[model samples]
Target: MNSQIKKHQACYTVADYMSWPDDERLELIAGQIFDMSPAPSIKHQNITGEFYSQLKQKLKGKSCVPFIAPVDVVLSANDVVQPDVLVVCNPDKITEKNIQGAPDLIVEVLSPRTALKDLREKKLLYERSGVQEYVIIDPLEEYVQRCWLQNDGHYGASEIFGSPEALALQSLPEVELPLWEIFGLEPPEPAIIWSG
Candidate 1:
């Protein structure tokens, strides 16, 4: 619980969120305000940048567009967030002020301060909002966890990928992420198999 909740008696909405100072880094989840202070670590930024760069390159000239954080993703009037990295395929959702709907893919690089919220509250929000795919990267652990929206409209069990593996995106079948490169790790040597 690194974030402090705003002490408003009433649940906040986008209109209230928009009225706040632009300098304040905050997120509204189900109308509750969560502070996003003490900016992320350098390692977090590095991993986020690398992942975004990879997605951008792979999605170049494609219908989907990639965006990094500080851009608002307005899931609903009261549910707005700024995911670390996101890809939105629908042009109509890309409004001048903010993204109007759930993005096709979202990536959140976990920091000590925001890990719990990202894994719990944000996960539920993204799932409920119909985000096609959600990816969580732990810079410290050098691993990734992914959740894809199931047929029944819920996220299925998370699929874990270690630093040595590549993650195939469900929302965009053409895209794959090199976890080693993303984590800035040396690729593990191939295991030598001997004939029995």
Candidate 2:
């Protein structure tokens, strides 16, 4: 018997990726599909964990529900996404099936395979969707960059930060999250980096 060949499958939209039953992690960048590496990098996990801890502590009893992936975020009918950490504050937006609307905040840790798409395609989607804040953390660069969308419904200039910068999220006017925590990446040193 002769072995038959298989045809390559094509995914032309984020919706196409979302409807698949298999748990093959993937994301669409400007309608071009990219397979996600299995499990995020350890450095990425640490950063995400630190951010989640800070956010969970601060948003306690608040309306915002912070979702850690593998939660599907539908940026559009065909542009589904999964940010490392996403905050949904609008009660009507949260749903039993999915986050049906714009998230209040979104954070994604960058990897070599995903850096370009996250910085461009996803960034634009979040902006147009009225996600109030978008944060992109680079493990290699040790950088956390954020953009607080302007009232005109688009992101203005961005705020670039490093280990020393105290991350001030736009949605939480009164709270300031220290960068040292998010980038600490491990148990903090006995000595505090800076006295606030």
Candidate 3:
């Protein structure tokens, strides 16, 4: 753990988190503060926007609503995260202040600064908090990894998809995201067959 993070671990709470300046982007997990700094790259922003756009278009007028980042999802007093993209199916969790419970789906676009934490710490947090689906996109690699909560109350192994494939979301059956479009990649050409 970073020395600064070590100092804040098991010491900070949501109250302290709320008292911070608006410009400071931080996530609290198990009472530890993780800084979201340096801003994301243009590629990262584009990918995040594409994912949100697709979710918004698919979920329009539906009970499930999609949200972009900077929205607090309060899993507990000591656990709050702002996923890059998220979907909440229950209206009650959508509060004027922040989401009070787990979202149905959470997406995090990996950045070099936060990739390991997103894959390990945040993954465990979402699993224990009962998030139904979690997606991690790597803009550099142009691939996505997804996991869902299993009946055993833990996340199953991640299912990986490349840019050419589409991801069918488990939380919302009707929603499928084109990975190529999301990653800003050219879609694979259709296969041709010779007539017999």
Candidate 4:
């Protein structure tokens, strides 16, 4: 755990990334190997799971297929990532090994350890790669921020949405994602038995 395959100090290739052990969770961004160790928080997992379930249900008979994390999304020779959830409409891009290109929609649930990279580095990379929609969910705030790739090849202003409000997917207008179902943490109910 102490040692990480640092990115800036050493340039890594996709082949090197492929040869890494299965236990090691890592990513390659712009030829830099980034260690994605330290698993996501419980809340992060909850949000990701619920959101993925909803997406899976919605895309059930459709061309778009939903994939959960730990699946390599090969953006390029130097850039490979594992988004929390992704929807790939192009079947050809999805091979047994990994997603060969940018997914139609990529969702990243922000955690303390990954917020900076998810919001900044990955945001830029997704936009440049022409991902149709990029969704960033803040588990702490319980809100989802969305960015759409514009006609000019740039991401437009992000639209922030919270619980009770639906997180609309620009790429797939028919799909409805209610924030409460994804990020809501309901309190436990009080004991109903009365003292007789």
Best-fitting candidate, scored by TM-score: 1
Which ranges of candidate 1 are over 4 A from the true structure? 1-7
lDDT of 2 by residue, 1-196 (tens): 1112111545356556655655566665455555676678888898888888888889899888788877777666557777899899888887776788689899999988788878998999899888999999988888889999898999999889887667888877756888877887443356657768
lDDT string for model 1 (1-196, tens) is 2223345447999988887777778999999988888899999999999999999999999999999998999999899899999999999999889999999999999999999999999999999999999999999988999999999999999999999998999899999888999999898899899998
Better of 2 and 4 by lDDT: 4
Per-residue error for 112 in candidate 1, Å, reads: 0.8
Residue 7 lDDT in candidate 1: 50
TM-score per prediction, in order, is 0.95, 0.83, 0.94, 0.90
Each candidate: RMSD to true structure?
Answer: 2.4, 5.0, 2.5, 6.4
TM-score order of candidates, best first?
1, 3, 4, 2
**Lowest-lDDT window of 10 residues in candidate 1?**
1-10
Q: Number of clashes in model 2?
A: 0
For model 3, residues 1-196, the per-residue Cα lDDT tens digits are 2333345345788887787777678899998888898899999999999999999999999999999998999999899899999999999999999999999999999999999999999999999999999999999999999999999989998999999999999999999988999998898898898899
By lDDT, the better pick of 3 and 4 is: 3
The TM-score between candidate 2 and the true structure equals: 0.83
Clashes of each: 0, 0, 0, 0
Which prediction has the highest lDDT against the true structure? 1
